[model samples]
Target: MASIALVDDDRNILTSVSIALKSEGFTVRVYSDGETALKALAENPPDLAVLDIKMPRMDGMELLRRLRERTAVPVIFLTSKDDELDEALGLAMGADDYITKPFSQRLLIARIRAILRRTEARAEPEAPDEAQPAAEPIVRGRLSMDPARHRVSWNGQDVVLTVTEFLLLEVLAQRPGFVKTRDQLMDTAYQDDVYVDDRTIDSHIKRLRRKFRAVDPEFKAIETLYGVGYRFAEE
Candidate 1:
């Protein structure tokens, strides 16, 4: 059973979501504020976390920023229905996903399951194949990706990425210099049934670039073409 931590200031949301997640067989932990969640999470990290953007003391954004410094636990932000900026900022700050307020419980559950599935798949070890050789790590310029290990490095420095970001980078780097439309990248990163806006993909790409740049200040492997798509530079 996957464990989930939910941090929100709303009592009703915490209670309702806890019950819903428990009914679905998830081990649920609830925190009424981000500060409490941050401390507990550092001591005992959950499989995934659902965080609300607004709260007393430390808000979700600060909590996420602090968490990203220590862990890569998948995070899904809960924002107000009209808070598009929050959603985008959360994604750019390393959140794996986000859902607006007044969202369907069913939709939230589906999103959680989808993210868990991706993380779980990445954690599982690949079985050896006698007839086929092991897949080689993809190396393009200063970037290197080991798909089986879910590891990425740039110029010998490790770069951590969420499952969504990793999938997007893989798809683009696999065909360097070939522009992949936003739709194509979305289809690759998200489940077929799950729907995400163009901005979501753009935010993830922005985060991806930021992560790579952290390791290499001169990183310019990811190129964006306005109004068209993005491509990995052929080096």
Candidate 2:
């Protein structure tokens, strides 16, 4: 069974989400504070994490920042209804997704399953003695993206990206010079009916560029079009 860690200051939220996830056959671990969650996560990482952004002591953002330093476990953040900035920041900080408070149990479960399915699908590898070769890694200019290995490099230096970032980049880079509107990117990167907005997608794109630029100062592979969307540079 895939394991999931739930971190929230509210016991009720933890209990409800844990019960729902457990009922669906997921191994769930609960933490009521960011400090405890951070420690537990460092000691024993879960397959996925659900974090509340307003927790005491460390807060979800700090915990996530710390988490990124160590592991690449997929994370889904929980935020208040009005905390759009927090949600965007969480996404830029490498969270896989975020859901607002008073969220539906069904929606939460659906998001969890969708994320897990994507991660699991990517984790599967071809048999060592297989005959056919794997698909070639997508290469654009000085950037390289390997879907099978889930790796990205710029100018021959490694650049880490969350799953969402990776997927978004792939969607654009695969079709260089083809402008993809925000709606198209959301449709490509997220499951059906996911409510990601333009600003959220922009934040992820910004983060992706920042990550690549850290390794290659002249990174200009991703381009923005005013009043439209973005595209990967053809050259």
Candidate 3:
């Protein structure tokens, strides 16, 4: 079972998230503060981390920034507010993905498993005698992306990502100007049989854009389609 850390200041949120992750067969560890969680990571890093945006001792964003400097482990933020600005900031700071308040357990499980699946897929060994490409070795100005190796590099440097993040980029790249509804992404990428809401797709995409934008200041590659869904790299 993959080990996952859950960091939330609220006891209820911690317990609920822990139970949800454990039910999915993950080895779950709960920390009520950023300080404790950070220390635990220093000693024994979990395969993935699910953090709350607001926590005592150190906020989620600060902890995430420090964590990125030391590890590329995936991080999923839990935020009560649904502000675009906060989502952008968290992603820019290196968060892999997130779940807003009132999200369902099923959706959370889907995100966790999807990320793990993608991470494992990307780590697969190369064919005998075939050399594996370096990480994020491709770029396309503000819209850098990779299809073969499952990575994306904005501008010139690598932007840390989880498996889900890379696949989301892939789906967007397949149709640059056309709108991709949330349902389309779910039908194409979300393997969970359960019908997860479109907001889940939106949430992950929001986080993905933040990280890309941090690397490219003019980044607006993933564009919203108002009442519909989203488009990518509009020509």
Backbone collision count in every prediction? Answer: 0, 0, 0
Per-residue lDDT of 162 in model 2:
62
TM-score of each: 0.65, 0.67, 0.73
Candidate 1 lDDT by residue in tens digits, 28-75: 999999999999998899999999999999999999999998889999
Q: Model 3 — which ten-residue stretch has the worst lDDT?
A: 134-143
Candidate 3 global Cα RMSD: 4.3
Ranking of predictions according to lDDT: 1, 2, 3
As a whole number from 0 to 100, the lDDT of residue 139 in candidate 1 is 96
Model 3 spans with C-alpha error above 4 angstroms: 127-143, 148-169, 175-182, 198-235
Superposed by TM-score, candidate 1 places the C-alpha of residue 191 at a distance from the truth, in angstroms, of 1.1
lDDT, candidate 2, 1-235, per-residue tens:
9999999999999999899889989999999999989888988999999999998899999999999999999899989985758866887688887777888776677678878887887777768787457557999887799987778888889886666778899999898999999989887766746576788789879878877877777888899998889999987
Q: Pick the candidate with the highest TM-score.
A: 3
Report the lDDT of model 1 for residue 146.
92
What residue runs in model 1 are displaced by over 4 Å at the alpha carbon?
1-3, 15-29, 33-46, 51-111, 122-136
Q: Considering TM-score, where higher is better, how would the candidates rank from best to worst?
A: 3, 2, 1
The per-model lDDT (C-alpha) reads 0.86, 0.85, 0.77
